[model samples]
Target: MTKRRIFMAGAMSGLLLPSIHAQTGTNTRIRNLRVLCGFPPGGATDAVSRRVSDKLQGSYADVSLVDNRPGAAGRIAIDELKRSKPDGSTMLLTPAAVITLFPHIYEGINYKTDDFTPTSTACQVQFGFGVGPGVPSSVTDINSYLRWAKANSGAASYGSPATGSLPHILGVLLANQSRVALNHIPYKGSAPGMSDLLGGQVPAFSGLLGDWLPHIKTGKARLLATSGKERSALTPNVPTFAELGFKDLVMSEWYGFFLPKGATKETANAAADAIAKAVRQKDVIDAFAQLGLEASASTPTELGIRMKEEFRLWETTVQKLGIKIEI
Candidate 1:
């Protein structure tokens, strides 16, 4: 298998730091910058946006805030972003799935990948499949869980942070490959879905590794497998889906920034520079690590390339799955 290049905050600093410059405005500071998050507050997307928003204050703008437009599996924020000004005052920090996977899976999606200009990527996260108390203790690993699900098809259901998300796709892929009857439950965000996972409202869940880490540590959830090319360092004992015989499932999701279409390259560069600087900070890096994300930065051009690559990759995968969703 080919290895994926992992960008680090430190490695990108030398390339991006020199690009940071002051944008011309009142008192040399932009006022009331808003970073939009598609998911509700307290989820991974919101956390990354809030952290970067704090760093953006004083330098990028006089005030920075996270605008939570949570709905329609993150499409709400995308629509809101399309209507936002292209002056760099507003930015969207969202999962790559909304750009890469949505167009493939969703019907009547109003926004296109080109509707927004790529700014910078905040971080990348791996997905994990976890089981809660609702699952039988006898089901320990992916194979056992699949067997249990097959035996109890009526009760076989999994929750994902949102519909048509990478986690949701991963769940569907697993069921298709294993020939198991597993239904999917979509949530507004990880917090509410995770609550049900611990409380046994759903027997299984596929979501970001961060969503399950705390519960797993507290013995409230059991991680079955991760979706990555290699084993996750945080859960070394937990095998990856590839290691568990699902080679096609190796994938990861990233949180990236984007400005609405019609934004100038200079404006995009300024936002990118601020985001690169912010994501590389020691505090930001440590905080992201706790959330099972690898904090990193990228040039706007680099982000655009990565986004296209991901879009193509998900296009092929979604085509193979033959899944199209409405809304």
Candidate 2:
């Protein structure tokens, strides 16, 4: 049988396809493909996954779907993905947080870095620090914000989607570097924290730029600085944290594709090529750019290296901050 046929059968049966001993001399035609994500339907992860999935569907003459399996800060979805068949048909599209941060913060996670093989990275989502308009800090830059917060008597309050998340670690890192005290308030997700920020219940929040862009434009919130090293093309006037004197504050949240571990190299490469082609389309690039996310693609090896680096970074940060959970 052809490699594609073998992969499809293995996907349906939840079994691994043995390595092809010789070249098939024919390209594999993908049939049904599922890309799993670990966030709610309307969140950033879901949005990007759907965008990529739509483009792939149009490019490939095959069935493609983006599945949402949000829970446990993405551990639930990761667990399910790990259990999936090691076939190209079943894959995952998840944020770096799920692989790099979640495993470090939470206990009893169902999967680890070894559970999957990298496919290709899709895009980089920029994060920013935003505050409600009511704050009188007059902090248009990161340095000034730190100065103003340190001068204040009480700990400055900030919000994040969850404890030990990228934003949370960034907040702590910023506080440590600036010698300022920040009171971190954790929320279940970005929606609730954003709600509190708009309602004047919280002074500031750190999250995806798209999540707070509307509020910033409406005068309900003011963006202080972004974590991305360079200013975003969509909001070039907004300075990066490095530009404002916080040199170590640069970071971007990445999203990428993964297949269940043990998939044949040829199957993984085919899937990655399909995804890279989909992401390269002008329509897909335009859609992601509109959300302040830059479109980029990486080989499986490159993604694997990135995951390892991010894992090390998160482990160090979590240990330093004493961030932990009871599972």
Candidate 3:
């Protein structure tokens, strides 16, 4: 039941930006760059931004900083981003859900889909529903969790990063599809949510796989299901929602970089190339792979097309899922 959409154009359109550097063949236009992150320092999105910033030092002489501006489920940072100068010095690197899902759910957002230029998609992350000591050990996977929810009235509640977030919406979809009621507990961010899970304050928690994978590996929390179509390479034994016959529950999470509106094509291309080169490095890929995030970089055009497609896809999916917030 996964919603399928086809992207017609090829992803790679070789741009001359890589070679169009100074005749000296040095990338010397070193301006201090700021990579804006909407989430706090501990989440997957922030982690990816820091990694990219670290690796980018090799591509340019600029001093890069990963700035976290967390609030309103990432609206604050994005609003700031939309208002910044159109120069390529400042960019937003955060989860695509903030771009694709927020406009539909949150009212009075200052930015629109066209407000920022999609630069590159850094990588993909999937969600996980992790259970802690508050839950009975008999409920192993999402299927059994649903069955248990039928028997246990209010005990079927789950915690997510925040309200109206992908995890929150996915929790609602799970309740609807499974024909059971699942309450939601929204935290300020994933770190707090995971902390509550580890402390057994919530019966279950939904967060990116990276947020819960280490706990799952250390036998502290049980990852009942992932939101990917296929099993994660880091935890192949764990079943995905699609693997459990809930195909419509699948939605891929991507961390994307976007420049301020009106950034020149040359600037955009330079930024994209630097990021793509940084992510493709062996150490970065290996580190990301441990968290089940593959190092996937896309051209600016490809990211733009993807943003449009995702915006459209989410419009349909949110309506179908009947997810609307009064904000």
Each model's TM-score?
0.85, 0.88, 0.86
Top-lDDT candidate index: 1
Task: Assess each prediction's global lDDT (C-alpha) against the native.
Answer: 0.84, 0.77, 0.78
Query: C-alpha displacement of 187 in model 3, angstroms?
Result: 1.6
| lDDT for residue 83 in candidate 2, whole number 0-100 | 77
Deviating ranges (above 4 Å) for candidate 1: 1-29
* Superposition error at 321 for model 3 (Å): 3.8
Model 1 clash count equals: 0
Q: In model 1, how large is the Cα lDDT of residue 6?
A: 21
Q: Cα deviation of 67 in candidate 1 (Å)?
A: 2.3
Point out the higher-scoring one by lDDT: 2 or 3: 3
lDDT tens digits by residue: candidate 3, 43-151: 6777898899988764653566777776666776777678766666678998888898888776665567798888898999888886988888888888888888788
**Backbone clashes in model 2, listed as residue pairs:** none
